[model samples]
Target chain A: MKLAITTSGETVDAALDSRFGRAPKFLIYDVESGAFTLLDNAQNLQAAQGAGVQAAEHVARAGVDAVITGHCGPKAFRVLSAVGIKVYTTDLPTVAAALAAFKAGSLSQAEGADVEGHW
Target chain B: MIIAIASGKGGTGKTTVAVNLALAWGAPVWLLDCDVEEPNAHLFLRADSAQQEIITVPVPQVDMARCDACGECSRFCVYHAIVAPGTKPLVFRELCHSCGGCARVCPRGAITEVARRIGVIETSEVEGVTLVGGHLDVGVAMSPPLIRAVKARIPHDGVALLDAPPGTSCPVITAIRGADAVVLVTEPTPFGLHDLTLAVQMVGALGLPMGVVVNRVGIGDNRVHAFCAAHHIPVLQEIPDDRRIAEAYSQGIPIVEALPEYRALFRQLAESVTALCAARRFVTQGDGHEHRGGGETELRPLNPATGASTTEGANANVRV
Candidate 1:
């Protein structure tokens, strides 16, 4: 029953995170303990050589069951999906709003697959 | 002395440094732009074209008349550019790294390697400097081969200044190998700092001795300086944040020519690079880890026993 939540660090509140790996910054919150951790993105590590895979591995190792972010690129989505991680989308700027939606059971796991596009 | 100017992010003025340094030297300094994908050095240093060569990569094209749909060629491709028997073996030309394993394993000898034009290397003289650059064809995937073409054009006897591609990818590796010294151009911003860290790692991984040049020095946080200090990388020169410089760039002129005062700064940059090259040679000749992985990161077939091709993934479209 460990839900790994991804949050954009706009405020000290919960916001829906739709992006899988390339989100500007990622906050991993433990649902049961309410303990939160921020991950400075290493997505640009080696500049697309191992950027996506490295970030995905770090997220996976943190035991995040679900990821919330702005968007998920195809490579990260494939890696996370293969490991049974549910992703949720949110437009909220901060982490507090995302947690509120999760607590209210209003935040739904994203139904579609992560699509790849350059921004 | 050979100097390489590289940046982790594009548009960070690698070509600008190389071109200006060549001008500062006044001698026939060899300027080679290894960016390959979008070489802008020519746009700045107007060169009279002395030579132009077409760069090509080996791609396996199936001869339908000779082969049955055995799927062996498809199986042999590590990139999975070739699909299995049901459909025409789809080749995502961009994704293909051009290792030629598919052609090697084809039982019918049906796979013939056709040279696909990837880019071109043009060599010329500009302001008494030998200028060379590889211009990648639009929509072409590979760059290392074109970079190789540019490297081959490097004159052996003089000071060769190489303008490397942005980012620490395969092409960057190809450009930086055997470089006597590297100048990492960076800005003083958060994004610049982040990418600079990766570039530092990449140059360190290659065991290439490198220095830093802070472009637009006073604009962002001093994180770039702090990073260089922590890493012990020498700071070469800081190009001032000026609008005239931008105007000069847009007008396609080297700042050394557009603004003569900057010529002295580039001259010093060239001098510093020579010093760095000497220092690296001294240190490396004493140390055992002197340039091990300086060649291409080529991926040939893993093992003949593993049936020529391995499963890339279930999602075939992920490749082609």
Candidate 2:
């Protein structure tokens, strides 16, 4: 399965960014192959408004099956769910740790937005 | 003539000046409240019957059947209002600027324009003065289009007084642009002085003749007066800090109505504005050339750290 993780850096060991919309980078990891690709989020980070929705659009376009992030806002959550992408919240130190938690079934699926829009 | 009353700081009496001026001017006057975010002119004017019309902007709607989503529309939009990730394009109406560039750029003619309501404009007559105001929908960020709609109702022959929103942003620019003259209302406090300078630069950049009305005098130092004096900008009127005015304002009764004595003062203010407009027209005609470049000198950058003026020749040819 293809999964996207909001991270502060490009590597798997990088710390998870708390902000899904303004994260510095996103790592698209193929769980079976253990390979990953980096998606730069600089444009959405500098967006004047609706950064969460725009970032959600970008991640949805990447064909990810699920998203692992620290928090998801209402607009981003709406867009991700509309594309059938499950959103999971995690406070793990690194992307690899979050992935382990996800595989162990410790992470909880977000029933709705975890934060308000523009948060 | 169109006269825009603007202030860089909020609660500096833009509506107070506008409502009283409309009331004092008697007939053949139109009061346009361009502060769509918080329109308060109607609260004072108390119009009998207001007619409201919805204002909308064109947003792109894609025809999925025509398909080919080559992402042309997404690429053409500068505001990222449309995004085509897969074979389908998604449209975000809130971010759309209604430039119609996406619709024109679509190769298959699949993109169509749809109306999205952003706000409404209301027009009514009160005491012989026509009041036109705009109210933007809550959470809607786009206001310039609605402001333009309110401006369209301005009559050519009568005097049009526009109460612009506070601050020197896009909305304020939209309100004061193309006016015959601009009346900048400000207080004497430091914050008021700081913003007044910015407003002056904006009006100067637009090449419009402007005058100052010092509201709530004696509250701060004379720095604002000094600044205007140094720039040769006319101090059109100085309204004292009176408790009765505030008392009347809180009750939604115009000062001219509560204190009939102030009627003559407002009438004099109106006459001075008219004379200023006439003088500006005479100067423009006498020069035999448009004053297109007169305002460029005042557009220089100011040192924000020191709060010092960097502009030179600010008063050259700016007078009416």
Model 1 C-alpha lDDT per residue in residues B1-320, reported as the tens digit of each score: 77889989877778888888888986778889888888888898775555888888877788778877676766676444554423334444455678888778878887778888888788888778878879999866668888888898777678899999898877888898778778999999998988888777666555567888999987989989987876677888899998999999999988988999888898898778888888767755776634433222222222111111122322211111
Distance from true location, Cα of A25 in model 2, Å:
2.6
**Native A-B interface contacts kept, per candidate:** 0.00, 0.19
- Over the stretch A41-99, how does candidate 2's per-residue lDDT look in tens digits? 99988887768877887888888999999999976776787678999998888998999
lDDT score for residue A89 of model 1? 68
- Candidate number achieving the greatest DockQ relative to the actual structure: 2
The digit string of per-residue lDDT tens for model 2 on B126-209 reads 888899999999989878899999999988788999999999888898998778888999999999999999888877766667
Candidate 2 CAPRI category = acceptable
Report per-prediction Cα RMSD to one decimal. 13.0, 4.9
Question: Pick by lDDT: which candidate is best?
Answer: 2
Clashing residue pairs for model 2: none
